[model samples]
Target: MAEKKWPETWQEVNPGCIVFRPGSSRDYHTGTWRAERPIWDNSKCIKCGICYLFCPEGCISEDEEGYFAADLNYCKGCGICAHECWPGAIKMVGEE
Candidate 1:
């Protein structure tokens, strides 16, 4: 697949608060601004989907093995996933 291109600055975005099209936010990769990232401990995970429900960016996804994983491409690392994990399976770590 071809790599997605993103706007380099806010000036490239639509003026005002209106989005010309719905779901257009998917076109922009906003994860680059995250200062921290969430790390998942599969051994402790309960698959409750709490993290998935709480994630603002909707980046957590189920893997082929049925284990939940974070898509860093869209995850802004807001820490909500880690906080919502009842099993304490998610931890926040500084972005490398």
Candidate 2:
């Protein structure tokens, strides 16, 4: 019997079907379905780390200066981070 090879990247996956492989979700870009994108305003940011904590995808990260931002590659644009931001530093903008 031939061994089944697992896809190393998301592009290799068949359309409309997903193969159950360990850690396969990482290979897929879930952010492609996002209708909006999050924009961070450094001026209004308080460095409270609220956005990082509120992110459902855990895509938010802190910078060297203590500012938080999301990685758009994995961010779903759910706006949870922007909505939870106390200082309104994060804004959800429609994708063009």
Candidate 3:
């Protein structure tokens, strides 16, 4: 019998999948990704589409008035959206 090896990084997991560290309170990025949560800076947002344009998961969306938001269930917490926000409306925060 062979023991299954635990993946050491995010790249080893299937895309859009993540697991928390064994004893930590919150999840951490695995394989190639360090799990990051999105923090919205509402005052800084100018309703620009930069973050929306960069989100690979298509999880962020806007209401009729164009307030941007993330649909949490589909969000993989990838920081590209946050990293690309021109006005700094979005920030990738460590899990609480």
Candidate 4:
């Protein structure tokens, strides 16, 4: 019998079936699924980097001014960053 050819990547898998792949989430744009998005209040932000550390999607990045901002392209808006922020710099707002 011939050896079975298994899918090596997420793309190779059939549609509607998600294959677990290491670091493969970056290839897909899943931010649109978010009902709410994070907004940063720089004035209240302490630049402690707490939001960046708590972001589950890893979409938060330090901007030029040293404040952490979420990349809307990949941010799922789970509100984790906002929930974890102690300074109340990050707020989750409903997406209009």
Instruction: Flag clash pairs in model 1.
Output: none
lDDT string for model 3 (11-67, tens) is: 566445544345432233231243667778888989988778888766679879887
List clashing residue pairs in candidate 3: 9-30, 9-31, 10-30, 10-31, 10-32, 11-31, 11-32, 29-34, 29-35
* TM-score result, candidate 3: 0.59
Q: Write the per-residue lDDT of candidate 4 for residues 1-96, one digit (tens) a residue.
A: 222256446655556764556676676788989999999999999999988888878889998889989899899989999998998888899999
Which tens-of-lDDT digit does each residue in 1-96 have in candidate 2? 222456435765556665456665776788897899999999999999988988889889999999888888899999998888888888999988
Q: Cα miss at 91, model 2 (Å)?
A: 0.8
User: Order the candidates by lDDT, highest first — what do you get?
Assistant: 4, 2, 1, 3
Candidate closer to the true structure by lDDT (higher is better), 1 or 2: 2
Give the per-residue lDDT of model 1 (tens digit) for 1-96. Answer: 223346436756556745566676787788897989999999998888888888888888887776788888888888999888889999999987
Clashes of each: 0, 0, 9, 0
Which runs of model 4 end up more than 4 angstroms from their true locations?
1-24
Instruction: Score residue 38 of candidate 2 by CA lDDT.
Output: 93
List per-prediction Cα lDDT, in the order shown.
0.82, 0.84, 0.69, 0.84
Give the 10-residue window scoring lowest on summed lDDT in candidate 2: 1-10
